[model samples]
Target: MSLVSINPATGEKIREYEETSQNEVEVILRRAQNDFLSWRKTDFEHRNNLLYKVAADLRSNAQRYAEVMTEEMGKPIKEGRAEAEKSAWACEYYAENGEEFLASESVETDASKSFVTFQPIGTVLAIMPWNFPFWQVFRFAAPALMAGNVGILKHASNVTGCALAIEKIFRDAGYPEGCFSTLVMGSDRVGELIDHPVVKAVTLTGSTAAGKAVAARAGGALKKTVLELGGSDPYVILEDADLDQAVTACVTGRLINTGQSCIAAKRYIVVESVAKPFEEKLLEVLKGKIMGDPTDESNDIGPMARHDLRDELHDQVKRSVDAGARCLMGGEVPKIKGAFYPVTVLADVTPGMAAYEEEIFGPVASIIAVKDEAEALKAANDTPFGLGGAVFTDDVEKGELIATKVIEVGTCFVNDFVRSDPRLPFGGVKESGYGRELSQFGIREFVNIKTVYIR
Candidate 1:
């Protein structure tokens, strides 16, 4: 079987990569095991220097790498470039803070001297997705490598070019040949890695279904795992919310990355008193947007990562509309050559409808009106997903109450949209999967924290 990358913007085949044979997979895993032995012994200063080198490499060739992302997944050129910049930042962030994060902590014990030390495990398998292809891998890889563990990436097949390019970046920065490598393989082969003797742990950034499968397999193998799954994040708008601020933030949050993000604001729960005005302005902003070839600088939206993904999104939209949700704006799929989904807004969305129930991974927004603050909080926490959410209101005290006390999500913003940051931990709760990424906590995920004492 071949791994082919098709341009969603033109339905054009970008390239095809040969699949790795079983024997080759064995060699890769063995090499990673061997690499870990030496890598884990390296000093923090050595790893830190190489991290900065990788960051410089990404910045120097950002545009070229960004084009690969745009060609493969159809992100706007500008956003793709920004993704590269963020990838670089992840490298620098780990470089600056990893040593302190992994440092041994002293504990008061009856024994004269006692403390806890962090040591690296062996190889880690990263099963990443195509959306935000570059940032996703680097966000995991930077800290994993910084903490002295090697990685083998089984990235989304459609973004194989990106996967290989990342390998090159690490090698160019002077990492050992086997320290990081991309496996040009299919999803079925992920189990081979999980069950391998050399692989000590696993991490994934994808769907809820995929996360569950990986978690089950890793559990069976007694391997550590970190899974980041799905989200139907809510953006709660209270009656006291500033209409102008709420409208702008919601529009940007819903339309970011064409709404393909796991943490993007998919559901907007608005209080009844503010629903009419908020909906009026949101529709105006979404309708006035331009979308086309991602390479074009003027377009705000671009084609989804693939046609089938876009088709699935349209199907979700269709079901919601048929179930009585009203389409205030572009809910219809474009009858064009590419996999472009329109800027869609589904109003009067209620519980039990597809729009309100499922994660609509596209440029679609669902507005659910509520009678009061209590109902608004209930609606925000109604979904099975508990990834990320936001609370928008002019009353700072009220926004804090909702964001901190009410929303049952991993991360919630008081007056802004939800996003991942290098400075903070990012992940989800409930069926959204377990474990955190980024920041000090993320760098410690793959390390073995052993308690030590001297009598």
Candidate 2:
């Protein structure tokens, strides 16, 4: 009847939350539908004002929220605080831009006048992951609320504590009672939530398998769905790249959030001319990263969110090594009680290996050596997952060409790593999931674009 939160760093109990029952879910659904009636008509200025209030609350109570995140999931304490700030930024961003994004645009027609208006549908069901819990929810909530849609969060079970805290943030910010609520339950309940007539759309950030299931459900219900799923993003190091800069960016790219990011550069494809140096430089850079307690701000790598996740990552590493990929460094699991794995580097990764073929969502970097730039492009686009990809080259024009024209991804970077920004759209291609989640593109994802004509 209750969901328990366990500390991934220390394997300790945080707290237990009562799961929402069937009856309670029905009430929640009703309230969301009721709230939408008035929420949809609220002026953008009024909505933005409330969003600004939410931003204020986020910054003021950032630490309190950070602590809960660090305890519930193994996110570093410093990163946890930053997540709070980032969430605040998202709120402010939506507050400032929602009106401009949803503005009615005139369309030329034979009639006297014509235009298209963007309007909110109803309640949106958000099934989010624990890796970047607060940020993901805020990114969706800020835009949805500003566009006049209500929200119902069904967050990852492990981080239900944070979910409850988020629900409190909305309530404290003076949103309507059902404007935003967290469902403290497991995945099995998601289908029921999505099937509710009041829930007009669904947005999920998780694995490909989960996205497909949710998409299918939403499709069957004839409801809109936006899925920001998994990614095995590739980063290419060309012969002309700045070795020092490439090494630094690639290290941070692969290791951010202990390598749990969906858009993190998972595969390192290097031309043979510079492959040896690149591999050497990458290993040297990662050697200094401290892997330990998430509570310690000094620790560069923390325990993974769960023991099974760590074990699964390890299995991937082992399978890759068995498939003829060489472990360049740190392939062994630790003796610690918590779910901890050292920063691993695998070289000679080819198409047949697990490291080359799958998404290894841990602090492990896999390297593949290609003969030339042509081969590098082939290697980078070899995977089914195409969430993001990047290229490093001293030739700026050439890098841009590769990043924009050649790489098959939702977002591509030339010199920098792939990251989500409030200004630009972010999502994926292939099996990574469809639909954008940031910028003006994201704000309009769940809105209804109705056409109006006057003769």
Candidate 3:
């Protein structure tokens, strides 16, 4: 069977790639294992220099990579470029910091000299999603590779072109023959890949169901797994918030990546006293957003990654409207060609509605009005997802309190939209999956923390 890449913006097939057979998979795994043995022995200076070259290559050809991504998965050309640059930043961050992050730590004990050393664990399989195709893989690859582990990527079928392009970046940067490889196949092969003896660990960035399945499979193999799964992140707008600032942050957060991001703000929990004005400002901004060809650069929103995904989001919006939510604007699919869905707004969202319950992975915003801060906090934490969140308020102390102490999420922002940075740890709790990515914490996820006591 072959994996087909489609231009989601035009509903046309871009290319088809033949799937990797079991024999080919074995060869790749064996090569990766061999490379890892030597790669793990490389000193920090050599690894760091190679990664710096990789980062330079990423920035130099970012636009070309962006074009490939835009063609394959319907990401806006601008956002695609930004994604490539961000991926480069991750490469540099890990390159500069990996050695320090993994340095042995001395611990006083009864033994003469006790310390913990981080060591590379061989091959790691990364199962990545289509959205932010380049960034997701680099975030995992840069850290894993810098920590001395080789990577075998099983990216989403639709973004196969992107997966190959990323592989090329590392290959051209003087990395060894088996330092990185992309498997152009469907999800059916993931289990076998995880079960491979050469694969010492697995990391996945995708849906919750997929995470669970991979986690189960990897667990059966006694291999470690780090999952970055689905998120229905909430933005709490307190009564004391600056209406203008709140609307801008909320709209930008929700519409980012056309709302395909797992950490994109999905729900807006606003205190009732300011709900009307906030909604008015948000609608005004949404109305001005242009939805059209992702290649145009003028369009503010592009189509969902696939026709089926767009239809699924529409179904969720329709279900919410039918279940008592009020549609303020843009609920229907556009008549134009492609998988485009217009910027949609739903207000009065409450329990039992699809918008309130499930993640709407499109450019749709759900507004939930609350009686006060207490109710707003309650509504924010009502969901099963604890990925990321944001709080907007003029009262800095209160906003900080809500962001730092009250919200039950892995990361929180005060008066700003939630974003993943190379300097910070990004992940979630509860159903959004466990384990962290980025920062020092991320680089250590795939390593063996060995304890040594010298007498």
Candidate 4:
């Protein structure tokens, strides 16, 4: 596919970009490798200063950058602004904590003194998605750059503008030229890039299929990789849960970014005693949601990032309904001009249906009624993808018990929706992908752990 930015809200081509030629990519690899020699030697204070500068620049141009993201990916303007702010937060987070995270540690060895030290491992390749363009890239950039490794970004083809803008952010913040670069290229070129001598490791945040392809190539080359793939996270509501708060959180959790988030609550597994009331309140809250142009401040649900995605999600919902699932609300695509799908709620969903089996990355929630807590836990762990999950209950001990019992996820939140924080490691298990990002654990992923000894 060509590298271009097409506005999903209006189906208009904003701009087209030429993909980087093989020769140009080689030059980038060479430059990044050469620059790292000097960049890795730079003082931690200098690196911290550059990170602070990046945070300031992101905040200064938040509106313009957010608008670019909204235009390129159909994210609501409010969410777009929030994304920009979050990007800045990540920059600041690494700036404050990275040096300490990478500091040498003393260890007891047979010698007089021995310790472990963290060091950069040359250049890294980051393959990112478009859903939260700025935030996703910055999360990787902040920690990796602070750890003294340069980055070459292979962002989603449709978010070329956002990709270029991010490259500029690092350059403007005084990172040496080529310390960070964006490669406007197709998916086919990624394998070649991975095998390049200068590219030492890879980090990817995308679908399961894409993750597997990249991991396979990186594995053959013996390069380390961190993969954050798709998720069919469960949002369980127990009988003792706070119905009022649970309903409110579900609405926001299930529909954030039009339910396109990997951590969004896709499956709603509630105990039968509370299922009826929860479903009723969920529909009532969903009815008030406004779907339209992302630029509009009042619009809650925007168009899918692309037309094909909307069609695919619609097909999944249709198949589920045909296979004995009942639509609780908003089953059909809205009569809108762009790639719009209504916020659908499906009831009586079973494992055999397409909706239950597939990751429906849209504004659709599948409700599965369970007899009790035992069955609820069983239903939640039934998916192949286990990126993130949430549990709601008034009893803290009960919530914690259920949280621990659920299998196949990176993080499980009690009485809240799944979210990423700068202080905690985030990743997934099973087909969802391996490795971690964010927090101290994330910074260590791209570094070389070296042991030093003294006789």
lDDT of 3 by residue, 36-120 (tens): 9899999999998999998898888888988998899888899988998999999999888999999999999999999999999
Q: For each candidate, how many residue pairs have backbone atoms clashing (under 3 Å)?
A: 0, 0, 0, 0
* C-alpha TM-scores of all predictions: 0.99, 0.99, 0.99, 0.99
Score residue 69 of candidate 3 by CA lDDT.
Answer: 89
For model 2, give the 10-residue run with minimal summed lDDT.
414-423
Angstrom error of the Cα, residue 392, model 4: value is: 0.7
Residue 67 in model 4: shift from native, Å? 0.5
For each candidate, the alpha-carbon lDDT, in order, equals 0.93, 0.92, 0.92, 0.91
User: What TM-score would candidate 1 get against the native?
Assistant: 0.99
Over 4 Å off in model 2, which ranges? none
Which residues of candidate 4, in runs, are more than 4 Å off?
none
Query: What's the distance in Å from true for residue 97, model 2?
Result: 0.8
Q: The CA-based lDDT of model 2 is what?
A: 0.92
For model 3, the stretches where C-alpha displacement exceeds 4 angstroms are none
